[model samples]
Target: MAWGANSRSSSRSSFRNSPFSDFGSYMVVKNRKLQEQFNAEASSSSNSCSNSGKPLFHGVSIFVDGFTVPSSQELRGYMLKFGGRFVNYFSRHRVTHIICSNLPDSKIKNLRSFSGGLPVVKPTWVLDSVAANKLLNWVPYQLDQLASETHNQPTLSAFFALKSCAVSVDAATRLTDQMKSEAEDPLLKGGTIKGDNLS
Candidate 1:
């Protein structure tokens, strides 16, 4: 009856001692182990935070401006998840770091009043640190590290901002091109409806 063979003998077992059986069993065991590991890690992290009686980012306050890789809201959520605080205002006393692709011109005056240099870093500083599950040094991600700061003023570089803008433009251009191509496809062309004569 298999494939219209009309013979029982010809319909031999396709799964006889097959490797697929072993693979399926292996996958089940692997999945179980993975779930256990994840649970253990989550519990450990939670326990550590509770036992220390201090948040991971105890002394750090982060401020987000402009558009970022994970979006400002998502970035803030990540920070909050890691026991960090997000601030709306930018000040040396309040904000420890300014996370943005571009530093707003208005903030420049405020940055000048700081006693020490303000760390203006890219959003990847947050993302990478989260990925590593530890706080990372801000020097590598600082947007204004190269320029000299004599008056404790924060400096920003156009390199990361321009790159982010170019990437966004490329993505938008690609989306527009795809839409245009889909519109020009013959299968997408609407067919005319015709009425049948009943008289």
Candidate 2:
């Protein structure tokens, strides 16, 4: 009976020492901290905006993605100041816009597939809207439009087609020029050349 009790105690100790044993406690503590921080920020932001007159972005909420020009922190401050919500995580029902400077093709495709036509706009849209003291039309700030216009880039298929055409034209021109030169050469005009033997 003593040995059985000792074994049970040892087993309990080992289970406590396992890597995942503290995960639940750790997550609880982390979530508490995050909640506290959010509450503090919200109170401060509300205080600051209480006397600032009407909020420009009262109905807007944004989720930032990747690297942004004004940075996520600044955007968060802007949102809070302008009476908008800055979501730290992507929530399809809560997020009204996605702010990003750039996203890779695969990431963009994934976002588009699931985002249900959420407007992906540049950081400039927020800044310019803040400056103008109103929400501007988002059409001109669309990520796809801005990327193509700013980089002077064509669509993938069009780019490949243009490259193939250029290569073909260059090769054909070189072959045509070589044939014309060989035909005009006087020394080989009457000779038939075959496999390094001339007759």
Top model by lDDT, which number? Answer: 2
> What would the TM-scores of all predictions be?
0.42, 0.54
Question: Whole-model lDDT for model 2 versus the true structure?
Answer: 0.79
- The pairs that clash in candidate 1 are none
Candidate 2, residue 108: how far the Cα is off, in Å: 1.1
For model 1, how does the per-residue alpha-carbon lDDT over 1-199 read when each residue is reduced to its tens digit?
3666755444344444445466577666665674465345434544213234655555667878667887887865665556666665454666788887755556655555552577778888887876666678988887653233433643355667778999999999999999888677765545432355355
Query: How many residue pairs clash in all the candidates, one count each?
Result: 0, 0
lDDT of 2 by residue, 1-199 (tens): 6759988999889878865457677666665675467557866875223234667777788999999989999998888777777877677887899999888878877887778888889999999988887788987898974457547857899989999999999999999998888887765565654345454
